[model samples]
Target: MSAARGPDVYVGLMSGTSTDGISAAAARFLPDGDVLGVELLGFVQQPYDASQRARLLAAMESGSARDYCMLGADLGGWLADAAAALLAESGVARADVRAVCSHGQTLWHEPGHSTWQAGESAVIAERLGVDVVSDFRVRDVAAGGQGAPLVPIADALLFAAPEHWRALQNLGGIGNVTVVPPSRGAVDPTAGVRAFDTGPGVAVIDAVARRVRPQLPYDVDGQLARAGTPVAAVVDALLAEPYFAAPPPKSTGRELFSAAYTARLIDDCRAARPTATDEDLVATAVSLTARSVADAYRRFLPEPVREVLLSGGGARNPVLVESIARELAARADAPAVRAFDAVFFDGEAKEAVAFALLGFLHVERRPGNVPGATGARGPRVLGKLTPAG
Candidate 1:
């Protein structure tokens, strides 16, 4: 269905698999009938306090019922605060905002079956004094589809260039790609979109970094990786993960590449090659991320991509960026791998902006899930809306 009207101003909050911080983006949508124009008014990151982050990480791996209940409320309040902080920082009036869309903190994601993102939308609504739209994945999953790569809906609506085929790659904890074709005369632009997790992005990298360098959040500028060497054997084995070859309309997150997963990988590397250093494991993780992305593109994208637009925290890492560019270059259908800046979009805040767009879609009563990306039976209006009291 077409968008009946623009959502005007709304705040979108995302706490990705990274579990580090919440990205709050204030976006204003200009009316365009069925296709709205997205304007990112402002973006602010609300980092989790160290103690909270540790608790959240624990809950993600395995947690008791009490822990889930408590953290869910706590995260909801955190998201509300994040949205408020974003509006204040951006100089947007709370009265002007239509809603706050929270992707919440994904605690467990089991693809086609069940997914859990802990954050109470009612709490966000009550605190923010704005409507809340959340729990976006369940509808898609209920329709016999993997509830993931939801950002492709944003890519198709906001970033599709009329000139070339572009792959909007998000190098978050898990690398995912939204391949958008050149907008061709409004014959259902989303029908051609292809999106899915490209595989490990920052997950393995960060896990190894935390083990080796507890003082740092991640490998700064990929220094550690640059100093180290990759074990191709390990990289190949990681690439062989069933998820990678499973085909599109697929999605993955920390569930598949948790800290324990990385530990297992390190153990396997040490078993096969006795002298694998911490740096080597880290570098191999980086390699695994880059190669997996390129491999997905080669196998799935039907059309030749003219450019690959990078986003997410991974974009900041020079080594990761260069590695991805190099991997793509080796492909027969090489495309220019460009930063989000190349397209004038702030890559780091892209996902946050994406959720804003999703909120806009929900406000307009338009379907947000791209069936092709999520393997859903059809497009579904994602998210549950909670009205402010």
Candidate 2:
């Protein structure tokens, strides 16, 4: 794919864990920290129907090779429709767009070696008539890195400031934090950066909420969670998982924290109370998410971090936010865990934007994946592109 000239405008498409809808953003970027332009320009959420959401979730949980291919095509078609809607809503013609950078829905993400993100780029490209950059994580995994927390690459470029020590924590279906050190130039192309799946984000909470309420998309404002207390035994059992103890250069997904895991948790907690309320179960899950984050910060970050900026669906949950704030306050030099606010609440759009920026970097022959975060041997140009006919 040829790099577009003179502050190119790129469209980034992302559908995260929540599966609430597709998020698309148009960004005009430069190599330096300057963002020439940004437009939430085409923000439209196309939610999957109940059956479709079920199918996608099943395909994600456990499916045969054939099932994956079929689902991939379906997702691609759906994503294309979403793209068309977003463009129409924004009045941007397909030809006027430089390229589409997609973080195709992840079915299975095994960070140590391989990862999978569905939604065929061919379908997206053919439908949109623009080159598409997809399959970003595989290259990083092939290079012996955890093929995740890809946003740190963008964080290093756009958000990293020399004056302040910052942590960009994304609370999507899963939660991951990117710590940007005060020194910008210290990150070498060969040495990787620090990042990993902190733990469950809204993934667990949303899953359990759906099971309990069956009507609501989530425990809105964490109402159910806020009403109950955390089950200590359940939280302790969860923390014992080997994933938490493992060092940096790691990643995780619902594959590790799945519905079955939730069942086991429910069973465990229920054994103690025999009638553990749905609210309690949700509360325990919320505590698990927040406590795990605090623990990860204490264990991974060498120095005191000043701020934790949250994005993604979980940022909207008051109970989750309150729990995280309390956890952060306990430390002597604990940083403030705060929401990104509506203005910066690009949680819905951040991943998509990151991919767009990465696509631009790849187009420029510059490295995009963080070697340190992904555990790659060196910086690698991420993503494969299919040209528009």
Q: Each candidate's TM vs. the true structure?
A: 0.96, 0.92
The residue-level lDDT of candidate 2 at 166 comes to: 78
lDDT of 1 by residue, 29-142 (tens): 775533557788999998888898998899977889999999899899999999988888999888888889899988889887998988999899989788999999899999
Please give the lDDT score at residue 366 for candidate 2. Answer: 79
Tens digit of lDDT per residue, candidate 2, span 1-389? 99755436678888887777677777767544332124445566678888888887898767888988888988888888877887888887776777888888988887666888999999998988888888888998898888887988777766654566778888998899988766545544223346778989888888888888999989999999988888988899889999898898788888888889888888888887777899999999899999999899888887557888888889889899899989888878988776665435456667777878887877777788887787788889999988887
Counting clashing residue pairs in each candidate, in order, gives 0, 7
